[model samples]
Target: MALPAPPKANRRAWPALLTLTDDLLEDIFLRVPTPTDLARACVACATFRRIITDRSFLRRFRAVHPPPLLGFVPCWRPGFLPAQPPYPSAPLGLAVADAADFSYSFVREGKWKNSPWIPCDVRQGRVLLKCCRNHGNLLTSPSDVELVVCDPIFRRFVELPPIPDDLVDNRRFDLGHLLAPTAGGEDEVETSFKVICTAANHTTLVAVVYSSVTGHWCTAASRSWTSLSTAVPLPCPGGSSIFDYSQGYFFWMSIWRSSSLMFDPIRMEFSIVQNVPKHSPKFPVVAVGTEGIPEMFILSDDSFHLLHFDIAKGNEPSINEWQLRGTIPLPRNCMFYTTLGAAEGFLFLHAIPSLKDPPDYCLLDTKTCELKKVCGNHQKRFNRVNAFFGFPRSLVK
Candidate 1:
């Protein structure tokens, strides 16, 4: 009798078939994507409902993926940071504003080149930054002559003290960031981290961290601030950028043209990550994320194909076991805007192209595999989606 057809009833068997109780079974099912799945599992019985909502099960969701290689993707806009006169007496950095304000600039196509106030050279524009959790507020950096902290979202920013005139003139370049405490509350939002690289002096270094608690930039007994030179350029968003905090250290990159320097906050060192090995004759890319892991890639068929990587582990020198992973290919003549917060299971993409009927945007997806677009509409593009931004906190908890 064909071995009794291998027990046909086992497909839907609930209690007896599996060792787990109805409650436990539903808990496993909660991890499923849709609410419909949760609803169905709940209806399986009261036992199912109890397990599905169990706080413990949800907590596991906090880490949706293997601890992500934390990284930052610049919140890219269409045009460029507004630049000033052909007559400005001093050198300037990039445009800085809250995320909301940046979006308005982002929405206005060609404004980058079109805006007269915006510098003709985008590389000299302000480097903007947003909170990993709070994506609306922007951290602004205009130029070495003056520093302003304005919340484009609330229209309120604290004016930062300008660097000394002598210092500004002496320094060839500058970089900055707004950093919050590693272990703190949702409300802690004041301290700022700034760095000015004196390229003219052949010295690369960080400036200072102005602490709201003490109302001054934290200074060491040596009467100087800390330095974060990871041999990698601690990219100040807007260019080839990647700045993340992992293993109690700040990881970043500062890209020149074909090369970059990796900076790790803990070691306070700068290391050259030569694209010669990671890049191709085609396109070159690199990133530092989730505990300062370095991921190098190349463009092939409009996608950034990962070549190899090693995340922030402990000492003994972390290494990226280089290997081709996947790619995020552009649909048209577009490119990735930025990559931010590797949370649950996906990586976020801030992408746009001049030719897009509407415009490109930051779309979240995954690092290991290509993802289908969540909402394809410009109106709803920024809303955080599931499979992107790694895994959802809701699912984890």
Candidate 2:
């Protein structure tokens, strides 16, 4: 019968990835190496998008592969420096820089049209900014300002309710930090977030937290600076006073005082960690150590010193102690500038080789001890640049 039509090819013999079950697909996706690849995989089809966008899947993916550092957003400027050539996440970072609104045009709606919004913090693909007059004094107590949290990728924002009058009175807002939803044990993404704004009076240091879930501002913690240490003067608000969030606590370091203020969001308490090496550089950055403890990286004259802080226990009462873990010598001809920030085990440093040469933005891998330049000779100067370290995702609730 016509040679049996040459025996029709069997479609079943070919691989059918689309036919895979949801569980099997998620298992396969978990093995995806980076969030950039994961984001690309999301566009393959509707099925892939559905599975990847699920909150449960995202939580699992983050646990396995932490989000990548996409770029650096200048604190005062309106642009960003994306990860460029040779980096594994270069493509994704470039895509974000091209598509996202770093200028934050969306906040210009209504009464905020002319108000300038300064980025206070960036975490989990969201930017936390404060909207106020150009002449506003951020260090003053009980000021009139609006806090806006936005996802530039999705071009969406929520104006956080103002801090309660009682909480704001006599308090100077000094620092702000953004906390992810999972940080509070919630699985949902983008539907909610928490903002911690720290303020201080001459006598008391106070933290006021605004929760999107509840739509209210509440004082999370407050402690007298004198109680922590009389020698440590009130942390003067400045660009050099850096803060990092690690192990569910917010640590604020005062470079001049050689002390750090630690805030526990859950317990609503503040503790003091004293005796940071006085001789280290002014812009030392903090990151989580391999053992889950907080560590500090100090860029000295010729080497980068790693110090691990731990609670020393005995009959002498518990105290925070810093131990020298290791050091990495700086490459020849390179000189320390200032630390930009730290994220995902990498400390971002801005270094100048010579007084005549252009500066470079470099990344130092805390675990592997690998150092490389990510961006070179950025044209626009910035007093502070915060590392934005997460991939854009669906904002659907």
Candidate 3:
């Protein structure tokens, strides 16, 4: 079965696979399935890396291809507790799941992983976890806290400098609100974002600003929490909050007070939003609404649009209020829960089944009306579900 061997010159002659135009290379790279794949491809060869890492190439890639769903981080309750040594504490770490199948991977390889840091808020793709460093006493004054901003998908984290001594010892103030990725474009993972800290005293809302671009933490300005009275839900800054990035505002919920705090990052101003009506409907209020109906934020026509839906016994799911839009019919038996929240065009219902059965975290697409079960039997572990929403994978600095 032996055959004549080919010439050595012929065997050595092979064309390079990367000998293509930049446009062609970009087209190939854009087709990569996920961000992880893109990252891996960038490391394969110098030419490929250079082409993929170019600013224009990355921008075009994002425009042509949709962002990936990085995963969900289970933000545990009893957040930002005082430091106690002997008592048992809940493990503070994110339960990261895959976008496609909702599979999970570890953050920082799950090292020690016993810290008490809990997530305050997740914006753009960044999770802000904070914990008190040292507490002389919890009754009289607050403790010095450290905030760690992390990109769970990237597994990169940075700890901001400690709070100033005077701010820590002040009896009237508390780090009630924290928001991250303070700067840079929303599409890019830039390290230039700012961490805006809102401290609530008796009557005034003091803001402490942290600039990653300048590497400095200074008190930006102060404003009065003057217009409204405190509500029964105990309106802490980021405790029950949602960010409207299009409007550059963060709406903080006041459960019984019937008002929400509207914070502006650019102007550093605080205004009262009175349109959030008092509703004892069978459902829970999720996010801000448009034209007097509760709805989620939507981006369209170079401006922000509101997407609202009604879940009732028999009526088809339709957005009728505020210059009526199209209707999306839901599948049968899908409107079981009366309370829900919407993010990224999906509805997350508040369901806690009977003790004999496990709880369910169900997601329904507002556009498609397709229902899927996510995070099966997670209720047995944590006390309460703090943050659950769709987190699209982006380059959040």
Ranking by TM-score: 2, 3, 1
- Candidate 2 pairs with clashing backbones: none
Cα lDDT, model 1, residue 47: 74
Candidate topping lDDT? 2
TM-scores of all candidate predictions against the true structure: 0.45, 0.83, 0.60
- Encode model 3's per-residue lDDT on 319-381: one tens digit a residue: 224332443343343323322334444554434454555555545544455555544454443
User: Cα miss at 218, model 3 (Å)?
Assistant: 2.2
Pick by lDDT: 2 or 3, better one = 2
lDDT of 2 by residue, 93-202 (tens): 89998889988887755345565776767777777777654324435443456677878888888887767788868446455545533452344444677787777666
Question: Lowest-lDDT window of 10 residues in candidate 1?
Answer: 116-125
What's the residue-level lDDT of 190 in candidate 2? Answer: 47
On lDDT, who's better, 1 or 2? 2
TM-score for candidate 3: 0.60
The true-versus-predicted C-alpha distance at residue 193 of model 1, in Å, is 7.9
Among all windows of 10 consecutive residues in model 2, the one with the lowest summed lDDT is 311-320
lDDT order of candidates, best first? 2, 3, 1
